[model samples]
Target chain A: MTGPISGPDELSKREQKALESLLFRLADDEFVLAERYTEWQIYAPTLESDLALANIAQDEFGHARLWYDLLGELGYTEPDLIWERPPEQWQHSTLVELSFPDGGWADTIVRGYLYDTAEQLRLEALADSSYLPLADRIEKVLLEERYHRQHAGNWLERLASGEGHDRVVAAVERLFPHAMSLFAPGPHEDNITEFGFRSESLQELRRAWLDTVIPTLDSLSVPAPEPAEVVRPDATGRDGSHTDDWFELYDAFTHTYTELENPTPVRLRGEGA
Target chain B: MIWEVFRQEKKGDYHKHCGNVHAPDREMALMFAEIQHARRMHANSLWVVPQAEIAEVDAEEASFGGTTDKAFRWAMTYNDIDASFAQEVADSEKEQEKAAKTREAQI
Candidate 1:
């Protein structure tokens, strides 16, 4: 592996852009995914599950903060990183931005399963990232991710039996294609690889993700349609193109920001004004 | 014929296996435990159980947690998430970080 890039100041102009691209992709996906998960907080099937899922959402937001913190070191403000950024500029995968249908427990579990599986593989690949800060933060993210996987896996398995099986199958059919966007490359895909920001390519992580998830779902009799047969949505968020759902989510989350005339994003952890 | 004592030093604190006392029965065990285990220990509580009632699971018979890595359960795993924002989360993480190190040392 290449030696760590040391610090943001040490980065060349090309390297700086490449790092921002990777960080934005990572941060955006986590922030948006956590936002979706919070939607299930009080609505979960049981009180215990509600608490568990809420804690998981908090973990995701914490992870997003980790990536965003790195970006902050590069001189980006919190508002620019999220609240004030235009919806069209977000780089999260489309899968995270989609709203869960009402009472759609199956959809949430399936989406989480697909996403967490990819997340586990992706984080493993970044464990030895050439960027010291990213590498340093990998262990904590991986630790929390392990719980997210177990939580999703438990729900997926529970739903895959008897009557619950059909709903899971339908959810898979509807969501598997969107989940594929988790591996979709961003604008700095080439530079990220060349600069060793990540140790593995997205394609390799995708293959490993599929190898683990497809069979796990199959064993549970949850139908994951063949890769070639699934048609991807036109809005691949990596290219900054997102579905209408995303715009709605952006407006909803930024509601207070807009009405309050863009108050500074609150920093609950670490140093803040 | 034998009694086991567990002592909790304070409210909300965990009861630990301090030491056992030899006694004839549960009542006697409690009395003996109070004098032998709790005396001078600054205990908030004490528990006494028959040695026979406690089931044994040694290292040879079972793994406490799986031998595989389970760093996820520890608060230290989320290194970048500053726990100082919430006192309890930070406290839990600090405790877990210590436990994790102790666990690592044992292995």
Candidate 2:
């Protein structure tokens, strides 16, 4: 068993690099996905659903904040990590960067279901992380993620019973390949695993995710792409390459900070504030 | 009879009033509450009590926590004393902060 790493100074160069790689993936994925979720703020199917989705978006942002704050312990500022950073430097899965089709509520719920299931599995893997900061925050993040999974699963079941079924199916088919990128390892996978940053390997998390999600989707009558048939997208977003949509989103989100000549990003208190 | 349903979302969590269900009796009220209020939500357990059994004292009946300021009871009143040194103290301060806002809204 690995001992608790109290802070950045405790890590070697290789360990630091591995931690950075892991942090970038976790932070970027949540930040981008939350940005996408904000698009449905007023445009969701109903006011109640709108509020629910908006809360989920805020939860994702809060989770991102936790990861980004961990990175700060290594001497990086928020501007250096986000607003002022180049779009290509981001290491999120392309799954989050893809734009939602207009009024595609089905895509929102289905994407959430896919992401949350994978998130639960991966967070569980990090529950006993030797990195003290990471292990400390996992429980709170996991608690919030449970609500997200329940929200998505509730929507998926309700939608599948009505005219929304076809839309959900289309979303599943169109996005499955991209969603698989969630478990695709970064270059520091071996270091991340060997250092006990995460107790389970990405391959194990991926298999567990598939086992849980496949049957859940099947039960809803929404056909998921078979595990063997999932091909990684050309731009997986883990390698610093992303689709054009990511650049567009990056520009929009950072427009204010870029134009102001001040790189400070605004912050609000409370988890969902 | 109308029976109000309160849902405990998870273990150790407080039960909150969700909504009321129409039923002929207490037993049927619980059965209806399970389907209506607890069906779609993540509820660990639920309680259904007859609406009439709940006594209420509205604003017109009684004033709550008094109309005068009771700032001395608040942790924030002694803001110079740092609560940050202890997590429990900080948590209590936060709860008091929320309670203060809620009391203000009530007044």
Query: Largest TM-score belongs to which candidate?
Result: 2
Q: lDDT for model 1, on a 0 to 1 scale?
A: 0.85
Error of 1 at B85 (Å): 72
For residue B23, give model 2's deviation from the true position in Å. Answer: 20
Worst 10 residues of 2 chain B by lDDT: B31-40
Worst 10 residues of 1 chain A by lDDT: A45-54
DockQ, all candidates in order: 0.01, 0.02
Tens digit of per-residue lDDT, candidate 2, span B42-106: 88999999999999999998987699988778777566786567998879999999999999999
Per-residue lDDT of B1-107 in model 1, one digit per residue for the tens?
77788999999999999877665456546655665555335899999888899998899988877988877778885678865689988799999999999999999
Candidate 2 chain A lowest-lDDT run of ten: A263-272
**TM-scores, all models, native as reference:** 0.72, 0.73
Stretches of model 1 off by over 4 angstroms after superposition: B1-107
Clashing pairs in 1: A140-B77
Name the candidate that leads on lDDT.
2
For residues A107-208, write the lDDT of model 2, one tens digit per residue.
998899989899999899999999999999999999888878877887787788788999999999878898888988889999898999999999999999
Q: Model 2 captures what fraction of native contacts?
A: 0.00
